[model samples]
Target: MSDSNTSDFTNPSSFILQGIPGLEEAHVWISIPFCTMYVIALLGNFTILFIVKREPSLHEPMYYFLCMLASTDLILSTSILPKTLSIFWFNYREIDFSACLTQMFFIHCFIAIESGIFTAMALDRYVAICYPLRHSTILTDPVVAKIGLAVVLRSGVLALPTPFLARRWPYCRTNIISHTHCEHIAVVKLACADTRLSSYYGLSVVFLVTGVDVFFITMSYAQILRAVFSLPTKEARIKTFGTCGSHLGAILAFYIPYLFSFLTHRFGHNVPLRFHILLGSVYLLVPPTLNPVIYGVRTRQIRDRLLRLLTQKGT
Candidate 1:
């Protein structure tokens, strides 16, 4: 599987995706778990959405934010898994230049959106725990809607430039992307022209979005912890902490692997490309697969609703 043409072109007709450079032999086996996770992600997130929408009691600001998170996870996992599975199962890896860019945009855009939702969730928790009396007033339905709109806009506006930037470069070097999907740097690095600006811009967007969100989350949690500890009774403190456990788990599930993959991509020069690719793919799936489960297990309302639904179906 070599490039169909070796000559220079502003844009190749399509880019050949090499599923995972060093793990071609294990692709079928790998597809099993990837496909399984995709199914789980779909089922879990959709269940969350359905439960949240149907149960009027679950329509609080917290559940609203959870719905947003679920939707983002659905998009984020979907943008990559279908194509990835195609490559794995059928060896169908050629992606049109435009399609590739579209995938890249959606993937990155939703990632930022997901991060924003996490931040919003943190704020929701912070208000619920720290400013208990004003929580409802602070996160009214209109405010939540506005926040959701802002999150989508911020992520879309920031990621919108990525495709245009990548398209501007003459990709005369080769049309083969080393990783599973058309990642920003993976595609841009194939350009025969200078890619410093694109690389720097991508880096800046990561820092700008992730850095700011992280700072806010940290500050929110710090205040939350203080408020939780200041409660008069042990039961009050335990109950307050319980409310946030799922959110903390979801946050860790997303950020830890994401940062690891990002750092490995940019700085882990000695790290194997296959390891990085696998981690990147897993990170995309893990949060989506776990978020619903974490929330269901940790949130009494969700868990009760979910169990009741299951029991009804069984009966």
Candidate 2:
């Protein structure tokens, strides 16, 4: 919601040399809102981490992925907020090449991991719901460990090429990134050379990661649906579906906006920049804040634990 203001043309700061995107006026309305959300995201994630660490009962696969998601969400929040807030408050919009890449790497890395973790979470839910009898055997420590490792490694490897490939480009002119954060496509737009390869590579990575991930997610949910249908009573069916309500809510919130942002960028870049920015911002901002409330506060157990912990500290 903020733009760098100190882009001095006379001596374009080291960061300004790469051609700055026009820093549109800052959204004073959102600067503090996002900042507050940043704090909430951090605290929420840390609470999940603490709960998982302290409660041995929660050390299962489902909570494990939830902890991982919390961590990734915290990292995601931190990666973007500093720059965005800086631009909003200090108008110090300049970002060095190294800083930009650093920002880009963390943002995408966390995002990739988030995507992978969500898929893993979907599988966990699937195993728990569809194969309840064998859930423990199906998702053991070693198996979950391997899944975690694979998720991290896959995301890291896939995101590796983005920065590596983008760095090779000779950025001749425009560098001002329109959005609050340095997203991959937006940053790549600054490159002066042929972006066809880079764009293709980026899309290929998305398809390879998100496409496969979403397919698996769908499959897992399908199994869940079938399994739920086999249940006898109305209450049983409702209970089975209840377990996934928060997760489904989170998935919809995360994916719908992401697709919209991607499509708006691909086909409607000419549309009002604010529209794109708004959609993009909602995706980034809402998920983190809403996730804890949706997934944690809505759950009786987690809510009780959180409230009990808060009450303990109130003294």
Which candidate tops TM-score? 1
Model 1 clashes, total count: 0
Q: 296, model 2: CA deviation in Å? A: 1.5
User: Each candidate's lDDT (Cα)?
Assistant: 0.92, 0.77
Model 1: per-residue Cα lDDT at residue 293: 85
lDDT of 1 by residue, 134-197 (tens): 9889999999999999999999999999999998899777788888888888899889888999
In order of appearance, the predictions have TM-scores of: 0.97, 0.90
Show model 2 residue runs off by greater than 4 Å. 1-26
Q: Which ten residues in a row have the lowest lDDT in candidate 2?
A: 11-20
Which residue pairs come into collision in candidate 1?
Answer: none
